[model samples]
Target: MLSKQLTTCLAVGVGILGLGFARSNVAVAQEKVTLVERFDAANPYRVELKVRLSGRLAVAFEKGKPPEVLPFSGSSTLVYDEKVLPADEPRTAKAIRVYRETEFARTIDGKEQKADIRPAVRRMVVLRSERGKKVPFSPDGPLTWSEIDLIRTDLFSLALVTGLLPAKPVSPGDKWNASPNAVGDLTDFDPIEEGGLVVEFLSVVTLNNKKYAKLQISGTVKGVTDDGPSRQQLSGTAYFDLEANRLTYLNLKGVHELLGPDGKTTGRVDGTFVMTRGPASRGDGLTPTDLQGIALSPTPENSLLLYDNPDFGVKFLHPRRWRVGTVQGKQLTIEESGGGGILLTAESNSTLPTPEQYLTESRAYLAKQKWTVNGSDQPRRISDTPDRVDRFAIDAEVDKQHVQMEYAVVAQAVGGATIAARLPWAEREELRKDVDRIIKSLQIIKRIEK
Candidate 1:
């Protein structure tokens, strides 16, 4: 009887100990972990961003009328060799991105346009803010409007990716909200009026023998773009590489709606994006030496954008305030937002027009439109070489308001180009500065013979 009692007691003690060991194991598995970004200035990163958006434009809904919509789709793939460096005291860092490839295409109503930026011209210095990232022009030249659009597409930013991580350690199933800047950048909404991204720590998974923390994100945002008011519903996943201590991969899909001035929905888009960032490889060519002697900041002259039109064989530089409006046939139009206007016409001829002859033609055309010549009618020679370019300006009156007009006739072997600009007389000095820059930099490579 004594032996039997001793055996039973030992068995019970062993069972209790086994239960305690199991409980301890569970606790260890549930421990929290801190996920943070570790960016070293000495190391460069290669980032690949790909996006595809498809939706409808001109969504019209009227009483007793079927909804009408036009199909639209666009895609862009961009690869960048980026270096994250320290920035101003308050801001964390800025990135100098050298774009290796930028390919974009868009189709609306069965019309498609595609462009691939040349390798030599793909570079910019990025400055981050709560609003968004700003790409200051290089000392060489500014990016064209279309190029800027592709570069600034709605995708993950370094700050946005970092902001999604919890400030404190988070265990599995823990949830938190992302910062406003992150939400705004992801949604392409400025001045976010409502809603934010909710992030949840899903679990840790192993990939390629490395542990990664998976996160789930979902949210809705309402705000405005420069065009109009907008709303977005975003849902995505991000992977935090525990070994690397960085957010290396992200995938997001969302629906975007554009609203009119009256708060009515005008358009809608369904889009998805995937971004991956990793250390630059050996042959990536983003070494510190490659960036040596390269200007990392923008000056006024370098900030000017290069506008190249191979069809007309005309190339020039213009400021950011000016935008290319339309190009049709042999004519091109550039306009400022609610301000000045410029028009250019290309004509093929056996002879180039003289400065005096061009001026006579310009005055005659304006006179036919009831514009009274307000100032001197003589064509003032802007360039000493009238044989190359006959450029001049005139002041006129129409609709009881003073108007200033500048004209340039670029002379070539067998063809010529004409530039005409009209703006308010009071704002001539500032607007003229932009026109003068274009005139000085304009180059005619080849002429289309009529």
Candidate 2:
């Protein structure tokens, strides 16, 4: 996980009588920045959130239930307690974690309603590193259920999309993923396992001497049971400050439709959401590594690189020297020829699992397959709670090739799905240095597992 802790506008112009000419700052273009993603723990930002639903709600009503298409609008103010977690690895960049609290309020048909949500999900999540492209951490500590949903929902987010930014400075007409999860969540017309959205960089414009990134937002969301929308299409604009490395405001509008078995629209929703940040409340800046306490740097010597699966919400970094071998299904081979290597496999699904539960079931499955477990260890935790780790201690040969192996099976609880990563015996010691790094990198991306 990238380390935690830390971390819009509009204008109108009108030309009046032909007798007078006037200049407006709204016409001036804004300048770009060197680092717009930086955020400190003390200076948290506030968000003014709003969502409105209009248009007709297609429904079949037998009697008097009033008009189905009742216009609805809701708004809220949220504060994000953001902090940067410290990391010691050269290859692994530290990331920002955000804790959100919503002072929510809304209205429907001119009637104000309470904005009540399960408090469990309103937890802290680690944003991706701005220095590089890495999946942002959701509930960076011990992952939680509601928190996972919050991350997937990206409620009141800057549409930061968990650090899915342009490879370099971008100009008008350049495009990038709205959010890192977009490529997966909104693909091939699949059911949305969890709701999420993505933004694409459309262009840049200057308004009132301020720079703004004109982008498009789109995505797909299917519920975990595959019972949600069969298809989702979205689009929006984000006023991004290139110089400030921040998103001033975001406006998204889209329609997610649930199709009947016949693939016809059964339940459809048309909505709009906007997030605008208020003036920042400053505090002490970043905590230097010396004061990091338990959070220290990872050894950089022969460090492994993080390999993230954009779609499956799985990631692990292998040793730098390992070569890719056989690639089948969710299993893979990280090796240096026939000598010594590690065979690993990972899969994601809808069910939630405690580390202990996963270990128990996995052991049973392996035994049913005739694989003998010479030994095993009790499940342990690194960050605690839903982020527990399950270990499958091994001392036997089990592969089709019957290769003698001594490895471990580790599992970490993530949102929407459980990722099971298996390690074969061969390269256990050879690449042991990368074990911690790989294990820590195991997480579900922002996309839902469908």
Candidate 3:
């Protein structure tokens, strides 16, 4: 989901010092170097960061290595104004302000310096009416063509956080393409006119033995299309972690498109994102409640659920849906449409198996239940590797419900768990089509700290 809360900070700074000591007893030779000269030698540092998002943006910075945690903080604001000119009426304008904040530590000569820098009331963009007095602009209509172009430009550059601080220079159409499928047709799209872009550097910080650069940016839209003339605004900040080799944070806010005829506003999108630098750790011993911050509950309509919990190693999705009715809890009473149903339960005792082993055991277990196997065969591997997909099939009777099931089991290596979702017999025809979507949406959220 696009984040509603827009809070992010990026800071980058450098410090240099030179010291010389003379021998006490005899004449000594010493070289003198100024701090400014040392600082100038380290002036420009290369920075590259990638920010990923599932719900919120995860900022990962690359500075030739993993980023160091830097102490930092700051704030910034961007103001946008739109002026509408009517041939017969007086000129009128409206304005709005977008705010941001950042904080971090600065690194200098093997030492860290604490700093806070905030940029306030920076003008991002100014929109002007195209028709002037000749055409009457409606104050409450859809945005003009110019306005849409303006908003698009802002969205394109707002990912660079430092551009919003001190107003850095930006070339027109300087764009970074996300994944081709993710960004889709939006490739090569530009929001502002050529040569109208600007960027700002806000703050610098050092953390965890790493350095970071914070930046902010803005730009105006030039009349490129014949559709009409309009104005736009774009602003945001980015944190480049020099040590960790990743982008740690990024926040962007801007009018995506113009709404009304007077170019007031049609729609808007603003959000902030934070990302870790490397692969996430596996929490094998943690409980679901510990990791997810909430207990799992079952409902009557879909009471029973099954999931692979990497932390607990073994657990049921909805235990309440299956009540122990026999010795050793082998027999379970499940609520059914007719009244109730009985089913046997068993669990694996060894560490979670690979996808192949898990699927093989599940099939064998189903066979032991005496369920009729209408058809059984191994399916093609879903992944590029041959050992990734393990398939199984079962056609049987569970109470009155005639069940046909099949599944392709795959292990989430990074998540440190194996996952299996049963495919209903009726939906088997379309199972292959929908399976990828389900797999893509699977997530392992980190447990929140208490």
Tens-place lDDT per residue, model 1, 1-450, is 112322222232233223322332222227889998866668767677778999997644677664567899999888776777667536544677677667788998899999776565666666666456555454445677666666564354567776788989999999999987678778767778888889999777653345667788998888877646888899977777687786767778899898776788788999987777676543243466767777665666767887888877777889888888889987889898647899977777654466788888888999999989976456555665543666678889989988799888776665677889987888888898888888788776676676
Please state the error at residue 85 of candidate 3 in Å.
Answer: 27
Better of 1 and 2 by lDDT: 1
TM accuracy, model 3: 0.23
User: How close is every model to the real structure, measured as TM-score?
Assistant: 0.81, 0.41, 0.23
Candidate 3 scores a C-alpha RMSD against the true structure in Å of 23.9
Model 2 misplaced stretches (Cα beyond 4 Å): 1-48, 54-77, 86-152, 155-164, 176-208, 216-227, 282-450
Clashes per model (N, Cα, C within 3 A):
0, 26, 78
Model 1 alpha-carbon miss at residue 122, Å: 1.9
lDDT of 2 by residue, 138-204 (tens): 2213332222333433442332433445546665455554443333422223323555554455545
lDDT of 2: 0.46
Error of 3 at 347 (Å): 13
Model 3, residue 101: distance off in Å is: 16
- What lDDT score goes with residue 292 in model 3? 48
| lDDT per model vs. reference | 0.73, 0.46, 0.31
Clashes, model 1: 0
